[model samples]
Target: MAGSTPNDQPTTTPEIPDHVLRVHRRLVEAGHRSLLAGGAVRDHLLGLPPKDFDLATSAIPEVVDALFEKTVLVGAQFGVVRIIEPEGEVEVATFRADIGIADGRRPETVRFTDEKEDALRRDFTINGMFWDIDAEQVVDHVGGRKDLQLKIIRAIGEPRERFQEDRLRMMRAIRFSTILQFPIEPETWDAVVAEAKFIDDVSGERIRDELERIIMSPHRLAGYHLLSDSGLMQCILPEIEQMRDVMQPPQFHPEGDVFVHTGLVLSHLSEPSFTLAMGALLHDVGKPGTFEDAEDRIRFHGHDELGATISEQICDRLRLSRQQTERIVYLVRRHLVFMNLPQMRIARRYRVFEEDGFEELLELCRVDCLGSHADMSLYETCLGMWNEWKERAPSRDPLIQGRDLIQMGMTPGPEIGSMLEALEDARRESEVVDRDAAIAWVQARLDGRQ
Candidate 1:
């Protein structure tokens, strides 16, 4: 869906929320000038209601800090102060120009300047525009408002210079394009592809965060295609790139290639958590290696196993927490198991529920199937049975303890422990209906052996 566009006629204007307008007016009344800035302006021009709002001002950090009851010097050197109101928090930054960036992440130095320089220094044209609340006018220092109407993502200044200032912006361009459903202008896209390798200099945490946004965005498939097209995926996650053109059997997949199948799966995801999205994206990572040409058709033997291993390595490289890495690997490894859901016995279904990381495994399989052939009979059957078993079989303490077995003329050895476990399994499986039956079943087995 396209975002809402701002009113075009000079006399026609949409009503700004009273609270936000009052906040803007209050800043001006306190002898400080403020402009509704950054994303709010971008969202407004796109006719979208912004989720969060920020402000830019000509007031210096110390000056603005004294007026607000709650203020934080979020970027003091750059004249940025965070104002906390009961309703919300707003960032007010003094107009400034960056000196140069020694580190790719932060400005080496910042000097307070006019709005023009500040707008120019920003990453993208659409994000550079400002709304001057006091004057009730929109500021288009970089023609951002125009660019927004064009449905294009263009760098504020020279694409190369802007990328050099902060490498992560290259990824942001793709993200904004995906979020806005806008096309990245040719020059901007080329710049991102050319400098794609510099994305390595960015911290893993930052890159991971951007990746999560791209994968979780509504247009995740388009985002992935952009990443692949821009060559960023090759630099950041070559493992995903490896899936391209790897064929799957037409009998099952009919989806042509592994990459296309994966992309379809990503498109099917809805508000997927970080782990689920990443798991879906990497679920078939092993397909390339496992693909083999057979007499009748192609096959990917044990791709799930190898994909799990690859998922582990990728997570480790990204420095994810051990728990997260393990969960993702588990999900990838078991994604294909849903195919066996219908044939599983009730006891085995409950056992699947009890397995470590079972819930995540189920979700991965769900999206995987939904993305592919869209035939979900197996998933529906398995999930239904699994839920039914769980609901009916609330766990109860076992009837036959090892001590009980030992007291019944069984030795205190592996046999006793084994018998107790067997009884417990039988109870869970409904093979032994009651506590007495469980004990009798164990006794019968022991008696038979004797």
Candidate 2:
């Protein structure tokens, strides 16, 4: 049933290029009925480039194996096979209807069925539609094409029953809303809010992966809003929700409460690396713990250090890699270093800049300050001073190495290590240049200490 228009102008159906269409044609020519399915069709209709193409066919796993030169019957019992081709590989699954998902995951038994039966069991309405490559018409038994046009995300059947089969779909609804920038239909949203607690049945790794995508979305704020409204935030990330009413001082954080401040920072974020984003989110988590009100003003004493500890535990629980955990924790702990900038000398400034990934730390600082004050003067001042230092006295290797100190009548011990570090600091500060000047500076320090 190809689409028709008056005057035979050939209503242009978006063409699937020869390469991909040929793959489907090969399967059909082998006497197997096939249709392009899932995200590829959804993306095509949305005018977005699809990441991968998937297919559903009436061909049994054995027939699929014989037709393609390369195929893997990894889940043959469930009617799925991986078809390999020179250009790309696509997943071709025989139409399946699932049964008995009592554990909130995995179908107890999968029965081979017609395409219509398979479509009925899918999670969302829009993702249930399929495209007929030969007829050039979409097969929409679930009114999915209409839902897509309406920009609605609705469950396929009784929302509660669909969600009961896989609890993770609750979060997936939030993710789709964020990714597609579409509204979750009222009934669907209410069902999600009611069943949000079932998300605990899902694995932490799966939950973390979905949460990361939500945070990275362009509409992160909206996603978070949905997460809270649907009660998913309380189950997944209660620490964030705790910031809601916790107030900060009026002088520095005139923006509002801790949650408001955090949201503002998130909104300003522009595709930062994952570690940076996580760090930014958790940077002030310890503020609530360290909050104190007294005579002069409010204070979150040592919150930077405290937040680092909290971040470590959270990252570990979430199973982050050691290096990733360390980087995020470092950012959280050292975020307040810029506040001490006025007291630090040029040498101290050089030391701070010399730390690993110092530029990213500076950017984190920018986000921190702006979220509270919307004032970047301090950040800009530091950047300007750093640039000035680089221009006037570019960094270089110290003229005096540890070996030089050892040769200069200094024993090879802790004293020599200390002298070598002091010499490097002097060089960074332009206080000393050559070996002679370094020796003189070290001697002055040692003699003064004595």
Candidate 3:
């Protein structure tokens, strides 16, 4: 069966990339039924440019290996072979019906089957369809086309049974539903909520990836709500879930609780990067634990520092890259520093702009303000400082070295480094113009200390 694009334009066999098409054609001409399968077929009908064009074929791994000049057995046991063409790589997987999945990660055993059976064994209906390239039709044994048209995310078979095969599919369901802005079919939604606890059985890295996808999506607010509603948030990231209903100082955060503030921060962000989004999401992660009813008002006195530590742990648990963890943690810890930046000295304030992830910090600061109090006064002051610094763009390097301080009667120990820092600050403040002036300034500083 063939369907139409979102615009109701009649759609036929999906047109894959030329390199991938050659592989499909070769597999079909070899008497094996090869079809463009999975996301490529689904996206074609949705009038969107698909990311990858993977193929499914009736040919076994051995047959696929023999047919291609340059082939790689990516997953032979599962009947998947990679055909390396001149233009690109195509993964031509043999139709497989998985058996028992004891680990909930992969099939314990698989039986090579036809396209229809393979489609039926897939996780979701929207991803179970295939396009018969030569026949110019779709092979949808699971009613995937209809479900796609209905704007729904439904499992191929029994929703629970499908989820039981791979627990990560539960998160994936939310990811797909959130990204596509589609509602999960009733049975699928029920199964997800019921089996939410099983998500822990999935590896931390797997959960991290899915969670990253959700948080990084433009519809992250909706995804966050879905995760909380589906109970996955409690299992995967209880640290964040704890933020719910944590009250803040009404004078500063009249918007609502910590959870509401977080959602507002995330929603206000536009096209945020992974680090920025993660930074925004976990910026206040410490508020729940640090919440205190002080004599004056609600106070999360050291929430920034605590949140940074917690953010690091969460990032480490998720197996995030070391660099990204460092940056996100930096954002979390220093998020509140801008509140007092305007009061700092010229060099003291401008030096912050020179550090790594400063721009993102500035953006995070803006979004933070947008989420809370709508007070951009401090953010604007910092922005003006940043702009002034950019226009001047003073030397990031120090005007003088430790040796210069040593020559000015400063000892070789910690004071030399301090003097060098002071020298850079003076240079940034235009208090010291050149090497001569820097030397004099350091000499004067030593004289004053003495």
Candidate with top lDDT is 3
Report the C-alpha lDDT of model 2 over 153-183, residue by residue, as the tens digit: 9999989888998888888899999989899
* Per-residue alpha-carbon lDDT of candidate 1 for residues 263-382, written as tens digits (9 for 90 to 100): 998898888888888988999999999989989889888999999999999998888889889889988888877777677765566666878888777777777787777788877877
In model 1, the Cα lDDT at residue 79 comes to 82
Least well predicted 10-residue stretch by lDDT in candidate 2:
1-10
Candidate 1 Cα misplacement greater than 4 A, ranges: 1-27, 84-88, 294-297, 356-360, 373-375, 390-424, 432-450
Candidate 3 per-residue C-alpha lDDT over 1-450 given as tens digits, one digit per residue, 9 for 90 to 100: 235856534455555789998887888788888888899888888878788899999999999999989999989998899999888889989999999987987898899998889998899999998877777777788888788888999988899988889999999999999899999999999999999999988998899889888988888899999999999999988998999889999778999999999999999898888999999999999999888999999999899999999999999888999999999999999999897898898888877888899999999999999999999998998898899889985766667777766666667898777768767877888888877887777777677852
Error of 2 at 407 (Å): 4.4
Best by TM-score: 3
Error of model 3, residue 40, in angstroms? 0.9
Which parts of model 2 have CA positions greater than 4 angstroms off?
A: 1-22, 72-74, 86-88, 389-410, 432-450
CA lDDT, every model vs. true structure: 0.82, 0.81, 0.88
Q: Rank the models by TM-score, top first.
A: 3, 2, 1
Ranking by lDDT: 3, 1, 2
